[model samples]
Target: MAIGDILVDVQAVAKHYGDGETRVDALRQVDLQVRAGEVIALLGPSGSGKTTLLNIIGCILDPSSGRVMLDGEPVFDGKWLRSDLRRLRLDKIGFIFQAHNLLPFLTAAENVSLVLDLAGWPADKGKERARELLDYLEVGHRAGVKPALLSGGEAQRVAIARALANRPRIILADEPTAALDSKRAQLVMDLLRKLATEQEASILTVTHDEKIFDRFDRLIHLRDGRLVDE
Candidate 1:
């Protein structure tokens, strides 16, 4: 894609459940554009279609209409454009959720390294890379600790390290800081902002917290499956 052009594009997208009169509109002609290295926030209340939009952007679900392009490729054209979306997901996207989701059996470093290994990186290199990322995120000291032994904030940081393990082109985080206190939430937001700017990765976050709204480059609000002016 050309520099400054959209790294992500969702044009006239819509999603629905059921059929005929019983249908529920989960998304309504939602049009969105994300540039590389920018952070965008999707804000809304419950049932506002924020998750639907994020799922579509992540290529986890297909839109009922319209199109989606990633890195200038037509990945979604109202249907499953690629047969191996799982591979694409593994290679191009990283996801963080409200919960840390780290395996209880693994150390912080292992959690990150495992993803790299699954992506075909050599074990030695993956371990080295994982260490680098954890250190960069300031969680290096917790590397040998497992989730059960780490604090909530520390586990969340490990989750972020895992998300960055594959060096994805886009990062989609759903309520990443929901479980943290204000101070920790601010720290996570700052880290996301820095990563987006420094790594040139497009980030779209779904969140209810208003405190970090100003940290985003763009904010899109949704209500009842429709876009509202922010």
Candidate 2:
């Protein structure tokens, strides 16, 4: 509502890879806004820049041109403004990748606790919060299990808990349900929607799971690195 209240904003953003004969435009003058307590789906085919846009928004990649402000803070103006971008990411942005990226040696609870600890939480508090999130996500029973021992759905849930351990303002998910079956995917989507609404955090997900598109507050379509509406 207010100017400083926007969770995520991208204005005239663009990204290109390679040079000359090998050039590829990953994003083209993209404009997007995500507000608190809302979930947005970036829907498009491969090469449509869905993930590219997500990366830009998450501060994983800098846009070639334009601006990206997170929670009213100008982190990028084509080039990153914050010298400690990694710290900013850890503090404000949570990331869920398709790979689940959990530490192989750590149990599910430990994986989640690691993040909280890194964010300056006390060891006991971090573990307690991790357990809380795991229970909230219905993964409490598997909290002691390792990634190799967990199902695709369980692993993903753990990854989500790890992402949320820091209580970030924004959650950026890239194909979060890619590894799950339809039923599990639906369950995850439902959980994501509920989390965004209940936590008052903004969620931006890049997904090809069209069956769950109706669950999101908004859907922004992309084609050939550009926004398109039907």
The lDDT of each candidate is 0.90, 0.89
Error of 2 at 216 (Å): 1.0
* lDDT tens digits by residue: candidate 1, 1-230: 43356888889999999999999999999888899888889988899999999999888877899899887788988677899998888888999989989999999999999999999999999999999999998999999998999988999999998998998878999999999998999999999989877777889999888888888988989998888976
Worst 10-residue lDDT window, candidate 2: 1-10
Instruction: After the best TM-score superposition of candidate 1, give how far the Cα of residue 17 lies from its true spot, in angstroms.
Output: 0.3
Residue pairs with clashing backbones, model 1? none
Candidate 1 Cα errors over 4 Å, as ranges: 1-3
lDDT for 12 in candidate 1 is 94
lDDT of the structure predicted as candidate 1: 0.90
Q: Report residue 208 deviation for candidate 1 (angstroms).
A: 1.1
lDDT of 2 by residue, 1-230 (tens): 33225799899999999999999999999888888888889998888999889888888887999999998798898689999878998998899989899999999999999988888889999999999999999999999998999988899999999988898889999999989998989899889888877777899999988888888888999999898962
Error of 2 at 175 (Å): 0.9
Which residue pairs clash within candidate 2? none
